[model samples]
Target: MTFSAVSPDEIAQPKPELRIGFLLMNHFTLMQVAGLVESLRFAADESFSSRQIFCQWEWMTCDNQPVTASCGLPVSPTAPLDFNQHWDYLVLAGGLLEETRNPPAWLLDAVREIHARNIPIITLCSGAFIVGNAGLLDGKRCAIHFTTRDEFRQRFPKAIPVIDKTYIKDGGIISCPGGTAIDLAADLIRKHCGEMRAEKGLQYLLVDNGKSRSTKKATGEAATLLYDNPAVRKVIDFMRHHLDSPLPLSEVAEFSALTVRQLNQLFIKNTGYTAAVYWRRMRLEHARKLMSDTDSSIHAIATTCGFSDASHLVDWFRKQYGETPGSFRKRRRDVEKLVKP
Candidate 1:
């Protein structure tokens, strides 16, 4: 049998070597730390990385002693910190952020030192606070647990917290709301490698049915965004995936195995709105995206978003944004031009 030689470019790009330094301390969430580690493991699986797995890591603590997580899991560092070599990524993992009064001086010093050396820093969940203490997030986009998002903003006025996102990556400071650490890990894999490996990792972890990093809420704050409840999340996911042909409440209720009354109650309790109201808001958001991103006519956008007509969409648009869709698009485009120029 004859075979052709595969060129260097044709082969999968050599996976980038990764040295993830975990700055562990008391009360770090076990799942958060494990999720990140396991995702990398899955990336190394041939099913994911296409036989090019290149990542190595170790745990490090500030004191070089055994660290116990908030969930009572114990871990020991593989080595002590050495500042000679630059790290690929430095991740700080911990919990009880609101209660952590004073971070050790060494942590601050290490963060500042590594940061000055131009290493990318990442914070998990409440770990963002420590990153904030080091002043790395100043004037950078980041993510924090939604529960502390307001306070994070108040404390670090220069750091932008994306309340609606699962993570934020700006200026080499990657921050993810850690309450959903598994999602955060998946996101990190997607960043360090690519979606193919991330997807395979998710599959290996049995999280393939979960939403993509973009679609998942930052944390349990799904209640504030959509509605707090598993049923609501599922229903909203269904509707979003079928925006052009939304299922009726009856069908949604059936899918969720809940009666109409129960579903309505849950939606109301979580979002202060009924199922009908939530669906309308979802459609409106969809309409907004279509209007801003495409030159489709008002009628076309309205029909696509399940509105009765353009007039119906215009009424809702004006009610929500204080302007007509056309005006909103024009204003948004002007703003985009100004920012780019």
Candidate 2:
């Protein structure tokens, strides 16, 4: 995700970098459409002039019919779905909740065909609905927009619906909920196109690249990258998402397909801390963040972070930060007051 400004000679040379096939569903989201494709265009050419030099994206459809957007705008397909046609990633601009159930045969077939070729599928907004109904997301971690989390869970019980992550990838499926599409678009550019091209594209879009890093960490993506073991990563992510009520190590271990002892050993190897210790620190860190960012009382913050009471939180907080929660919150308030006009 690092993209420092390179010297003139170090800039990426023009070449065929990324090829993406965009599948526009009925009643698709137009905002996601503009942000994703426009970012890719900025990365594709010099000075915001799009010539598809470094990246190529096409609007496609299954039956060559015009796909109406949620805003009442009808967009004709650029081409029909051709399984033989190669693409780096097949992206879906998703639609409403009702569209998910009993999807049309043509749409389902297109997804199966595209996946059979081993091309990755990127789902934006509710498009995870399409992929999940198409049977492409079984046992995969799919990022769901907060509004659709419950429905996605009921429909696809095997698929893990992650509301915290901005974007996520599981094997061939990549997903982003809502406007997080911008960050996902940036990630795609940086992965296929060179770093220079990604930076230039964001520069034109005026996107702060630093926000992506913080968002990723806030979404538990930092822990996912710490260990290669999929089970360890899953357990850590579960821990982060449940900071309000930390689950037992045994239950989480079972969720990750590892026993309690096995999970602890992997955690020690990957993160240099046992599961109990790491999870405690994660809860304490969350409490600290709440103290600094919000105006909640100590008892409220303690409850949110899974502590029995304010005193329970303070004991652990002092052990970790060398000060009580009250002191930290006071210092942050004082510093902010001093800086404000």
Candidate 3:
């Protein structure tokens, strides 16, 4: 079961094709699975055809049984688990009530065997909990949905939990919070296939904005709340790009091509927040991400997030999160240290 580290030359010339195996948990999220599979499907061919020239995938289970999604959609497995076959990656598509459900004993043993063989493992959504339960996530930083952060911390104290990130790669494991599987798929495509193919796949999916992982989730959630209005969508996109130098209310209104009064009415009618209030919230979200993801100084983060100064950022952060930025970062760092061997 010994495996050599991948050389730089090998990475520079990745294999022309990849085999992917997906293990679906009961009541999995359909969107998460579809997002990842569709990205791979589109990247498998040149433009419109569904040929498997570069990537291949198979839905799998322990006993080749059909699995139902959280939305009550059923999908039949295409194959049973085959350990001897060469698989570039194996992903677990996790379910809704993951805290209550344990993966079957056979499946847990299969994952451990796969890990021993040097095959990379990916955990989407609460599937991370399964791997943590298997002792695979010990001494590794993993991604979990913010809603599950507290439960994950309580359950797997040996695994470092990272919030606000779409996906993280620690050693041979790739972990992501639920609902951002497309980003993870695109990253894999870029790494193995090429930049052109990955960009084309994203463009085909109409996600060309190139947002960071944390910001992408926020924007997606905001779009859902705004009811997909074209004007509001454009305004939000503009605001995201200008976080370090936010526009004034008048300019934002002008940019959206709506009168100031109309903009205010639209914001309140749709999101129950005025344009100014929404803008401030977006800034705060960005600041929180910076504080968690980077080691920038408080002053640097405040300036980057358009706060007046470090004190202003601290004041707003305390009001929103009930803690100063330094305290929050220190707490997270302490938790991370606990995961180290």
Candidate 4:
């Protein structure tokens, strides 16, 4: 299928500029900062022209000192912290060693002053801790990386922390788990710029369709089981939870509040697969994950993934991947060894 090209007139002209400020903490994750920045940069201009007509961003530090990322790359700040300019959003780009790095007094003051002016505060990754510490996150729903959920909850009891979400926009405070800053930037661009611009930004970045905050999971597992329909989502969730013991189609249909025929029709209509086929694909996906991440024997892996026996697994694995389980494992190991430094 071919996608329609966006014409010059179809391209949206940047209007009502959105200014964003980034507060980079020491040892911040580069992926988070780059994802947000690059997505916004794509949305700021039409197509690939690198113009800052729509969105403008500034990188700042409390003391105007250079900050090192978690990956050991150092970045110099463009300016010292100042609230003189009107900023649509103030993002706290958090670091890997969040527990050790405390927000200095000046940073906390800046946060409070920005909050007082009704500017939205966005926390990327462990940056939630900084806003939480500044009392900006009190009594607000927030999102944080799953690794930091428990500690964040204990540290800030008043703030409601949600782990099973990519991002949350509660009033003026927007919180996002790390590595999903691209989605957050796309959402902002969609709201401010236009859907076309957001689509262009994601296309330029080579990101697939964006995901909503509700579809995310705490373990950072892809929410592939989630479907747009509630009934379909319920069935998918049931199938995923019971992957260790395969459930019959009749029972799966009942859980989805649909008859077997209705379930089949729904599955085919939405996902182009019958319920049984979809369940089999999910099981195969689980088996592939086990094969790649664990050292389980074929028999053990088969049973754990709801296969009847080793032969049954081998038959299906070969049919799906064009290789037996043993051969696939060996090939994967060889590739890993060759790529290792």
lDDT of 1 at 9: 45
- Candidate 4: lDDT of 74? 79
Ranked by lDDT, top first: 2, 3, 4, 1
Could you say which candidate leads in lDDT?
Answer: 2
**Model 4 regions lying over 4 Å from their true place:** 1-16, 98-101, 210-341
Q: Specify the poorest-scoring 10-residue window by lDDT in model 3.
A: 1-10
* Candidate 3, 1-341: lDDT as tens digits: 11112233322121224568888887777777788878887876656655554677778765678877788887878777687667888988887855325766767787888887667788888888788877787766788889888988888898889886667765467777777487778767765555566677777888855463443454234353223356766887788888888567999999988998999887754444678877887888778767766889999999998888999999998886568888877755653443234
lDDT of 4 by residue, 141-223 (tens): 78877888778888899987787766776535777877748777877776555566667777888876534323223212333
Summarize candidate 2's per-residue lDDT along 1-341 as a digit string, tens digits.
21112233533333244788888778888887777887887876666445555676677765678878787887877666666667888888787766555678877888888777667788888888888888887766788888888888998998878887767776467788887376677767865654566677677888777865564444334446234457777777788778888567788888888888988887765455678888998898778767756799999999999888999999999987668888776655553443234
lDDT of each prediction vs. the true structure?
0.67, 0.73, 0.72, 0.71
Candidate 1 regions off by >4 Å? 1-16, 47-53, 98-100, 191-195, 213-341
User: Worst 10-residue stretch by lDDT in candidate 1?
Assistant: 1-10
Best-first order by TM-score: 2, 3, 4, 1
**Candidate 1 residue lDDT tens string, 119-202:** 767787678888788777765667677788778888889877777666665545667676455676665565445567667777
Best by TM-score: 2
